[model samples]
Target chain A: MAAATRPPNRPPTREIDEQTDIGEVYMRSLLRAQLRRGLTVLAVVALFLAALPLLFTVEPRLASVRILTVPLPWLLLGVTIYPLLLAASWWLVRAAERTERDFAELVERN
Target chain B: MVSTDTAAWPAVLSVILVAVATLGVGAVGLRLSRTTSDFYVASRMIGPRWNASAICGEYLSAASFLGVAGLVLTFGVDILWYPVGYTAGYLVLLALVAAPLRRSGAYTLPDFAEIRLASRTVRRLASMLVVGIGWLYLLPQFQGAGLALRTVTGAPRWVGALVVGVVVMLNVVAGGMRSVTFVQAFQFWLKLTAIAVPVLILAVAWQSDGAPDPSRPQPPTVREATTVRVPDTVRLRVDEAVPVTMRGTLDGVRVDGPVVLETGRRVVEGGSEVTLPAGSVVPHVESVRAADGATWSQPLAGAGGRDHPTYRLYSLLLALFFGTMGLPHVLVRFYTNPDGRAARRTTLVVIGLLGAFYVFTPFYGAMGRIYAPDLLLTGRTDAVVLLLPSRMLPEPWATGVSMLLVAGAFAAFLSTSSGLTVSVAGVLSQDLLRGRLRSTVRGFRLGAVLAVAVPIVLSFATLRTSLADTVGLAFAVAASTFCPLLVLGIWWRGLTKAGAVAGLVVGGSLASGAVLWTIVFGARFTDAATSVGSSPGLLGALLAQPAAWTVPTAFAVMVGVSLLTRRSVPKSVGRTMVRLHTPERLVLDRGPSRREP
Candidate 1:
């Protein structure tokens, strides 16, 4: 199917064309809002992950865990999964959209 | 909790269900797998929801099923990094490789290797490595299935392993990627429902059952050892433990522990439990108890504090954290989506699914603290989830539930193993026999056998490292190899074939060496450095991960060499990069002509 393009509710493209250095001006203005929102989400996720240990009941009494009577903290830590995923997913979405938008703009202008 | 009369029929039945479903799915997918594109990339048309479901099924393998909960049970709270890494790995994939790699007009890693650098030699080397890594990753999946079944139904270990291998091989050979996608999507729902239903039931049961009797207690924790709460049936270790009575809490859940510990070491876990020795006195454990003044509604184990803090553990963790972006199975999922935007959405869904599932893993691990505390002594924490079903639910129903879980878990392992295998095989067939094989059938045949044999051999040999560690190591190596490849391949205009080779060789060698070292060290001793180093494979990859270091390192080396010999640069380099990132509608000659609607 032809790509979907429902532009945001704002002044039409014909109005923006009137400005001097309008093409670079308009494109930068277009990308600015999205970049800011994406960065905000990123910062929030990072803060949340940093704060997780405080909320948990992991007031560590001992450090060593046993595997066949072997110390297991090394093994156990590898599987700490939930937070990292949330961060990665958040990061991936932002990057994908950014890359796509940047490339599409470059192509349209040329 | 084992009622002695384990007829093995339940376990066998579960395997049969998985096999039937796999066969059915593969057969159906085969009808769609008529063309080369369909067999390789599902015609590059899978939508977000369907692909997301399939990715979930394929991603949540033995590691997520048995290993995650087991780690939580053994190590306390520190192990949450794994599921997070696994899910986030996709994020890395989306950002680094997804759109461009899909745009590369190639089907497999080896195919990418040859196209980017135009080197037959590099393709062969990558093909060999892909098989090696694919097999290394597959062994744990097979071993996990065997472990799951053995714990759940007392079936012989090999039965579980052999059955999954056969099932996966059939699925792959019959339908290839097209078939696997359907099977995996279904498996994801099955596996999700399998775990989700039990967790809900257990939560309700735990709330209504009231706190474990507050009198007698078991080992590891101080508690009333008089009462027990098993969400599933597994062997309890209280019969032979020098019960350590103490109080504990997991994620703020107050678990009054008169825990029957065989020893003081209860954290940094590789999943251990107290098992009854034959000569020892207590045959069957009666019940465990809760403590007085335990305020929390549900009591859980306390997380362990800093063990011998190591720079190495941090590095290993860094490798896993950043390295997930490099995993092939995960990267393949991103390609399965329609575009970069869809890839991002799917990643969000995956994070939700993965995180919610992780929240409940600790509960299963904590339940093991009471009912089948003996699992520790067996040195197989990975089997804890498979065993939990029977211990929590009542007879026939418990067995049936456990049987279903083992099947689902097995499907998880089989699907992931085959998926990786298919990717590697695609690389091998294209690189080694691109022109020589002469037919797609020949390529598929060679790839299929290579996929099955390597992992089966590794599984049979009993690699010393744990399943989670091996997988982490794989992530690390993947990060090292592909992390640089994707970042440099997409962003930099100056990247040369020489640089790509250097980054891949240096990063891959270091990561592979770490795997070898960890395997060797794991067999002899559990010394602190050696214990963590046993899986330095990923850490080595981490040193190379952002490829910021390795890519530049590679770029510098390539430029110096390329400057020294400028004639070797390929004419197609500019065109290739342009094709890789350009929008589909803009291109005059649309790529991947083999794809059909």
Candidate 2:
């Protein structure tokens, strides 16, 4: 919208290309945004998964706890983990696209 | 031990039906796919959900379909990591690789290698690794097919492998999966329904039968007079004295009548029939560790054949979590997306699809312990998924359920085998046969033949390892090689071609060497031989699952070499990184959006 309102003689608001320094800056921002979101998701997921084996080792008796008529380990691994993964991926994808859209908006404003 | 009553016509018919449907879909795809773009990446038009389903179809090989349940049945709680790691691998892929790879516009892993490193030599090395990994992955699909067919129809083991090999070859050679997206998507649903419907029925039946906990420590017993036939000579270690009527050669002694087995190892001759009266606990093969219900339900208590359970668990998790990004067939599907964002979306959906399918596998495994415990004795634990339906239900319903599973199993083999053949053959045709052949299509057909042939031959020659374990070896190789390559290639700007090659060579050789050693010497060094000292040998555990060391070694070597060779970094590194990381919507001077082939 900002580009559309600019003066017509201003060289047609050159599109962002990899050759330009400005475009490189734009691309860097996008990559940074993406990498940040990716690492956040990775950290959350890794923490949960890494915690599982540690939990089993630290409190070996926790496995004997039956939740909804199944062993806690089976319930966590066989049942709950699937939904957790689904939700995490959903959140990450949504956040990733939002970041992309925001970057696009920034590029458009220039 | 061929069953005289080979009357599984329904299962045979279902396998045939699946083959016909796959061929029919492949033929339609062939007609529709005329251009090189269509054959390689479906013209980059696939939507997120459909592409996600196709990925799941291709990814859920015999390892996921049958092996997970089999491993869970035999190894207990620790085996749950197989499915969890499989699904979570996508999480890592989505976070690290998916969007960037799609944006890179490289059609194959070798193509990506060339694009990132700017070296033909590195490309060739990547191609070799792709073929190696593909062949290793394909081996288990063929072997699993053989085992599945033999279990279902009592057909000779070779027939199933032959049938799957021929069928997959036809599909790959036909149009090179120009329309593979639809075929694979259909197969995903077919596999899901196959597992889900039977599991639902079995669950209801289980509930009606009092829903007994499978974690009970007592050994499983036959409800009626059952006769078990051993097709191959097997040494079984009995933990308890078991009384049975025998009409076979047992440990160099022939018995035509009743005999009691003492609690030690005994060898039974091939083609021998052992009839057991009602309520006799099933004897386990000597390699399988005997576990009570309490130990079976607990994690890390009894795993990796009773050796370094904690270390093995971490190592296996490392391999599987990172390995998903490197599977050739899995990565190629990402190219079908129109943009980086769509690729990420597809991966997100794939996590959900794969997660849903894996949830039911553990149920099948847990139920198998109760109903199909005899498989432990037969050393055919992989048959648990197929046997559970028929074992639990009686008569006509059992036959119908069995046929459903047979179709699903065939779908698993066909879809995965075809996917691997296409990816492998693509690399072979492009890189290996570049100047030798006049026509790329012809070269692809030749490559398809080679791709299917080597694995089939190897499947026949090698001693059969458990399907999932064999798959895990492939994962380790993939994690050690491509995982490092992709991560460094995408993220780090200073990565040199020399670094990639060195890392690949070191990582690939070590992981594959371990796999080859296992295949060659694993049978000889059985549980009896490996557990010589008080402490189970650490070398055996390391060799068994080398991902913990090999993956980190690969990353270190890659980073180390890249730092040394920083001056040789490609001049185009900045441009390539820009292309890989930028959103497609951003106007940029990307030469052509669509690749020719």
Q: What is every candidate's C-alpha DockQ against the true complex, given to 2 decimals?
A: 0.16, 0.56
Q: Taking the tens digit of each residue's C-alpha lDDT, what string does model 1 give over B90-198?
A: 5445444556676666566666667777787666656766766676678788778666676656666677777777777777777878887898888878787777777
RMSD of each: 10.4, 3.6
**lDDT per residue, candidate 2, B123-242, as tens digits?**
999999999999999999999999889888888888899999999888877777666777899899999999889989999999999998989877566666667778777788887788
Model 1 residue B82 CA deviation in Å: 0.9
State how far residue B231 of model 2 sits from its true place (Å).
Answer: 1.5
Per-residue C-alpha lDDT of model 2 across residues A1-110, encoded as one tens digit per residue: 89778855321114344355665566667777888888898888888987897798799889889987899999998889999998999898888888878876776663
> TM-score of model 1 relative to the true fold?
0.74
Q: Which sections of candidate 2 miss by over 4 Å?
A: A1-25, B1-6, B527-536, B591-595
Error of 1 at B342 (Å): 3.9
